[model samples]
Target: MGTPVLFIHGLWLHASSWEPWVTRFQDEGYDAQAVGWPGDHDTVEESRRDPEAIADHGIDDVVEHVAGVIRGLPELPILVGHSFGGMIAQRLLGQDCARAAIAIDAAQIKGVLPLPLSALRATLPVFKNPANKHRAVSLTAEQFRFAFGNAVSEEESDQLFERWTIPAPGRPLFEAAAANFNPHSPAKVNTANQARGPLLLIASGKDHTVPETVTRATLKQYRHSEAVTDLETFPDRGHSLTIDSGWAEVADTCLKWLRGQSL
Candidate 1:
């Protein structure tokens, strides 16, 4: 069988958000599947209609859920994750769950510092309300435009928001925010495992949620490991790097890297 590539999406997007990616990867001989967080609806419309279905899920919950998905695969697949999904990919890599992995505009895991002002502003929707930690949060169109659509045109921003955005659990955000301070935080990843396989961290130059500085800090932490870790930046992109019009550029970059690994 060909190598499987599992796509994991970040907050505000359902598993269906990865459908186009799945098709692209399949064309390249990858058995790609997009996995969802536990309790996530199958579609964005369902998620938006009943947002509370995803309430109170923490980082650990999602980590375990994705781990379960990996366990069911025939072979250890190439894990590709976006935003919070990127963080999950790193966690799974630490567990030796995949052949290789890619994290795009990923949220910071434990020990990564240098929080940029833009990242803070982008996530303010959840952090601004402490109660959101126990609830599901939905981004306003304006918030989405600023955070995920800043580099795109206004019309494209609105279209993306309407098509892909959905409610996301806030507990994971809270857990990540406290990861540095908490000794036993669930957001921790084993960055020193040589057997964790290759990893590529992709950063969007215009991403407010995860700036290039943040991804650079993450790469620095991985440098301590014997594992092959790499970083790439896509200029003029935002948090919507995987879904925007220029998504193929990012996808092609990842494909080139994966081809080099001979996976």
Candidate 2:
């Protein structure tokens, strides 16, 4: 057995989307697997066929679900998460559930103040309707293109959408949008935990869903901690950097950083 590495996908993407990264990490001698959210199905088709199962699951639900999986592992795993999954990874790491965490384009936590207009547009599908808060909402191909594939070609974006996109719960987004105003927001992460494991923050320069400013804001939240906190940026990449043809580069970067950390 080797040090476990867990991959967490954000909304609109299936767990299987991390398969390539899993293989890459496994080839490098790490035990890697992508775990879905609490109500997610084992397969994309099954999840798409049954949207109710994935609806209404909030940030707390995902955190507890992944935390349970980590608790059952033989050793504390390294969490590598995308978007909202990134937020979940940080939350779990703060609780001392993992050895380290890599949060890529993580959603805005409670203390982050920047709100780029592009981010607002990317998530408009859910915010346009208050009722969506308790339902499963999916993005149109065009919307997916704008939010996740803007850095890639239209053809590649459509292909990725067809292969991995799925309906996502609107609760987490709602929770995050209202975090600053809520006292006990689920979007909050304990970034000041000096005793926690190393944390890595990855950002895409052209990400409309989570702008670089937002990721930068996320890093500042940990200013109170003296632990190993690092930031990496892929200036030419977009939110789909993890699932597109260029994923190997990002995965390799992650592997290199982990080895450097002696994980």
- The best candidate by lDDT is 2
Q: Model 1 — which ten-residue stretch has the worst lDDT?
A: 38-47
Q: TM-score of predicted model 1?
A: 0.98
In candidate 1, what are the lDDT values of residues 2-118, reduced to their tens digit? Answer: 798999999988888788889899999999999998778888888889888898999889988988888898989899999999999999898898889999999999999888999
Alpha carbon lDDT of each predicted model: 0.91, 0.95
lDDT of 2 by residue, 1-263 (tens): 88999999999999999999999999988889999997789988998999999999999999989988888899999999999999999999998999999999999999999999999999999999999999999999999999999999999999999999999999999999999999899988888899999999999999999999999999999999999999999999999999999999999899989989998
Q: Note the clash tally of each candidate.
A: 0, 0
Candidate 1: residue pairs that collide: none
Identify the runs in model 2 with alpha carbons over 4 angstroms from their true place: none
Error of 2 at 210 (Å): 0.3
The whole-model C-alpha lDDT of candidate 2 against the native structure comes to 0.95
Q: Pick the candidate with the highest TM-score.
A: 2
